[model samples]
Target: MTIKSLSLKRKKTAPHGLSEPTDLSAYRRIVVLTEGHTNPQKAKTAIGLLRFRGGDVVALLDSQTTHQSAAVALAHDVDVPIVTSLADVSQPDALFVGISPAGGRLPPAMQGAIYQAAQQGLDVVSGLHDFLVDDPALVDIASRTGARLIDVRRNGFRETAKHASFREGCLRVLTVGHDCSVGKMFAALEVERELLRRGADAKFLATGQTGIMIAGNGVPIDCVVSDFINGAVENWTLANQQHDYLLIEGQGSVTHPAYSAVTVGLLHGCAPDGLIFCYEAGRTTTKGLDHVPLKPLTDLRNLYEALAQARNECEVIGVAINGRRLGPDEAAQEQQRVSAELGLPACDVYRDGPGVLANAVVALREQVVD
Candidate 1:
């Protein structure tokens, strides 16, 4: 993809309660804007444009990848204002707009506004693709608006592959569970980091970021691995392909609405080799805990039995702990409690030293495939 193809500069809505002008000014300090989600190659091109211009980049918005869109994937760390209208945008020294797959031509009223903005000397730039076959009125408006259009999508994926490389056969670990846990996604990342530190290659296929709103309630965890799930049989059919084991994570009550039962259903369809359950062992963030009947292990064990029932040969691993900081003795006590309650050999991720997570994974690997 050429620099002109990303609709990075287009104005869009900012998330609510973020309308302070100071925040807007902070975003305007950057020059290039890439819109929507893009694959790695297209994302790299957008980054390159910013570097070449010697200006900071502001990702326009997130959406268009698997969960939100490719925009979130490519613009991972950049500051983006969830914009609702162009009026919220501060006049940048220059603007580079990224087009969506359908192309990002402004409608009549928007085009007229841009034209007026151009007359006042805004250097507007846009990257739109060649596939826009309709909307002459919009095209006519853009023509009058003097917005420079650049096409950038061709060969973007190939260029992206330059940065993409396969792992050295890591134990693929997946995190699944409750929808309401505040820092559970971080727990997944911690698992990945722990495994990688112990020389296990870990690939994290997550629904979205750590925060709840970004991840959204009722977001299908399968959406995270939809493409991989669809292509699994074919990829397996490629005899020369290296085989990497998968670890699927799920949360909430197995019966909770936001729980990953449906996601687990998709994995059952793909048929993975093992599953891990990460659960909160302490009081939940919700209220009325005193009145609720809570038999944590009984609830978890029942869920495990159901999961094991539907699968081919698959080993189940149980992980439990409170999120609060604990002393060494308290930590060890919790570990023993979980191991006994779950009726399986378990290790405290913290107390068994940092390498315990890796050791458990290796032990599980030997049981399942070795």
Candidate 2:
């Protein structure tokens, strides 16, 4: 897709929010707007987009790392130009708001960059809970300039969905974690990508903004009303139930002080066949909640399985370790120790690739069928 395709603007609404999500595959190239923010927690969405977009990411808008390679900055193996802004990238189709900072609010620097991109008629997409589509100024800019404001979190909510009777032999695997942002979405997406590479019919069911943007459409479960979280999960699952493997992106943590509700809701609602326990190797505390020590992986695994047993007989199949903060040797050692301790396959999905975990999950389904 070219920038012209994104300029077919529609006036947005307050309730359901903005224009429908566009299929990302159509975008020939995209510029991820990071505004040079490099904190891993802050730049995670940008990093994820660049990793999984399959070479569609043309440039990264980061003034701090401008003229450097994105691989060097994000610690990923992929290579993409790190440009200052949309102007630096020639004919990029869209601009993605790629920072998932502590608060969902857009930093002023990012806002200015987005405004410029919208004025330049680039369709702007964001997964941030701070809804850009609802901002009157941005709405007006999009309306006047005919550039669509695509809110990945708010748009494309599946309607008229029922509790699914998923396809026979198909599986739903939810990524549960020890804490918020412990690589649940990253692990889930990486496994899905691996399965797809193997020619398996796998789909990633996005429950968060970043996951939704990556998948092109999903329900941001955090944004849903409490009473409707199950319905929302059911809705998204039904939409993708045909795939042989549905990797649902998990949110928060079952033990998280603030976000436990969303975590339990996903566990109960998704009716997963197995869970992938995502963890950061050395993170002892919740990202923001320094007081609540992270539960041991065994405790976490048991709780998740017990919770799943309350509804269906789901189990924790493997562990997805986030070793981004560790050196290569340390990351490998940590994975080995964790795997031996848990008696489950454990690997850093990004650092080591998703093969080990993917095989375990696929084997689970096949073993059950057998």
Candidate 3:
């Protein structure tokens, strides 16, 4: 069956002045839309869903690279076939917008594809700052077809943090970064998995679009206003306090000129018990900010520690390296160099399993007698 002939059970995933669970698990066969963008950074949503969501993601929609395997470009282990249109794929439960453009604007091609998918009775899921529900044309078609518009970032802006602390005895860790897309979320996800495997009550707190989509629920902190960013983080942390470990995903670099506010806000709001410093192996400049330079792990560790001290006492306990650009031997060497210089265990979470970082967490927990 190429086209879905049934009506979608339209429901609001975005919490509008009300509390609701965000779950994307009901979508069994999702078609990831990343037309011209299939790279690691540009198509992060698609890549993340493929790598983490596993077999639920059926195909990648990229007309520019039709019939080509998306494994290499997306660094995915699965061979997600690239197709041109909705008809090219089988019965899709939903069409996922899998690229985060600078302005959150959908490309013309993706916009048309999403519309067609909705008209065909497939629910549309988006992670962009631009909510698809606002478009009358798309909404009208979806309404007529009984299809839902799932905007992941549309939730969690109505909160205002009255305090900036992760309640008492909350064993939470935050991933600090040298730059954006350097594997903070990936490392956090892996670490969460490892922690759970060890029988700990671990929860991965999603703070971005990709994380939100993968985890099915999280506050899109980047879309939050300056005054309420801290509150939003506080809100989510409070909700998940019962978990033994809350692995909060970090945002952009503190040195990043464009996204430093969210970084500092999370640092203050979460007041993490421990911090994991994530950095790319061979990058000297900030992504998309050519004029800005990325600081070394030592420098970032010191800065993050200092910033966290204002609200809570915490230390950077481990190093997670994003060595995607380097080969295995080179990545190993970089990890060794980082461990030696920083006096912390380091690993490329994607290249290696989460054992190293998880061990570091256990060490910290034991050392503190928690």
The lDDT of model 1 is: 0.39
| Model number with the top TM-score | 3
Q: How are the candidates ranked when ordered by TM-score, highest leading?
A: 3, 2, 1
**Number of the candidate with higher TM-score, 2 or 3:** 3
**Residue lDDT tens for model 3, 101-175:** 666787777788888888987878898877887787887887687777888877546677776444454588899
* Strongest candidate by lDDT: 3
How are the candidates ranked when ordered by lDDT, highest leading? Answer: 3, 2, 1
**Position 252, candidate 2: lDDT:** 92
Q: Candidate 2, residues 1-370: lDDT per residue as tens digits?
A: 5757554434443434445555554566788888858545578888777767747788888776534777777777777878875778888788998887765777877888888888887788887778877678887787777676777666444443355666666788999999988889888888998999999988898888778767777777887777778777876677677788999999998888888998988887788889999998889988887988998989988899999887766888999998878999999899889999999999988778899999998998886545
RMSD, candidate 2, Å: 2.7
Better TM-score candidate (1, 2): 2
Say which prediction, candidate 1 or candidate 3, comes out ahead on TM-score: 3
Give the residue spans of candidate 2 off by over 4 A. Answer: 5-18, 64-67, 155-164
Task: For residue 258, give model 3's deviation from the true position in Å.
Answer: 0.2
Q: Please report, as a residue range, the 10-residue window in candidate 1 with the lowest summed lDDT.
A: 154-163
Give Cα distance to truth, residue 31, candidate 1, Å. 14
What lDDT tens digits, residue by residue, belong to model 1 across residues 248-314? 3343444444434444544343343445555554644322233444345556456645664565445
